[model samples]
Target: MTISVERAFGLLRIVCEADRPPRFSDIVGISGLPKSTVNRLLATLGDQGLVRFDVEDKCYRPGFGLLSLAAGTWAGLDIRRAAADEMAAMLAELGETVHLAVLDGDEIIYLDKLESAQSIRLFSAVGKRGPVYCTGIGKAILAELDEAQREAIIAGLAPRPYTAHTLTSPETLRAELEAIHRRGCAYDMEEHEEGIRCVAVAIRNFRGEPIAGLSVTSTASRLAGTRMTDEIRPRILAAGRRISAALGHLPTPC
Candidate 1:
């Protein structure tokens, strides 16, 4: 039974990896299987909807059943679990705080956090609620929403100033969100806490909907100038892509 299953999967892999749909002879040639066995496996695969016989092209191709299976797997992925390695890597590299958060209406709730090694760190905990307009992860998630949804969310908020650098004007916040979306990242330059700053990116799901955010947090002085641009931004953005990819979000073509 195990050998039978392995042979079936081997045939499936040949079909799936082919640049073009392959004929029965092609499968038999590539798999080195006898004609009778290849025919039987192909017929069984077609019955299961794992492969389909194309009449016009006279070749075998992958079936929609594969998509259904893939969708189910992607949907079941836990965001925190998907992001765990990337978060730990960021903490190790920068010795700064790393955060994972999800949008909760007009705010963001921390899903997980890795505290900085330094004694002076941002005061936050898992499940803590934060303002959407001022924090890095919050703005990253907000920037991924559609214009109508973004506008509605902003209109509903009071937009109070959280610190000296926080932008209270809706017009300015909207402009910043637009910039964040365009650049594929967001920032909190002492906008939330007086000395804290961060860079963040949105994590999307299989449907291309932004479901969560990942960020790197540190003191403003530590994240300034060259370090922010060369090291931090690239790392956080890469982490976002890794997590989003794990959730089955395809990258938009450049």
Candidate 2:
């Protein structure tokens, strides 16, 4: 491996991990990079617009260039169209909301949503987004990532609590993702919204990476206990499998 390249990326990661703009001293301490090297790389990064230095706080934050790059990547995905038929079927059969989402940095962006026929139903806007450590679709995508990739994303997440049940600690969220991977599923136990609960499964690409996830959402009163296991979980998995197959993905043999 290229040592200098790795160190430069490590410094960048340190800045990204900070909840707010990071000072030079903080980057040096967290990255364990020599002060001189860190200073040089930061200057180069600033010139390239990968980071911007704030004069008032004497700290660095992610720059607009990074956001533009990320936007380009998210724009190219065809997740909404790919899962359209399956989502409609699930919504009709279960009479519950069906959601399709894909990871975007440390969050999951809702590509599409099929609302339930019931009067009491969850309604997530098509372009809505949620924390990767909290929502069912978010955790489903996170669970399918490689350990190194997932850890890198987790390092930058703030883990703020949206509800009483949110996993606000890194260790707990890490454990949760690991369990979801083993079980081939994830659950949102009112982690994002107080009245909502969901069951989700990852949607893999041809390469077997979870490019997206699908969820069946309902009121906590409807899905909070055995009803989820007895009803929602199986249907959600079946829908996810069909979508994955359409995307040219086949699960590997255990």
In candidate 1, stretches whose alpha carbon ends up further than 4 angstroms from where it belongs are 1-72
Report lDDT (CA) for all predictions: 0.91, 0.85
Per-residue lDDT for 80-122 in model 1, tens only?
9999999999999989899999999999999999998787657
Instruction: Kindly give the stretch of ten consecutive residues in candidate 2 with the minimal lDDT sum.
Output: 70-79
Segments in model 2 whose C-alpha atoms lie over 4 Å from true places: 1-77, 121-123
- Cα deviation in Å at residue 137, candidate 2? 0.5
lDDT, model 1: 0.91
| lDDT at residue 63 of model 1 (Cα atoms) | 79
Model 2 clashes, total count: 0
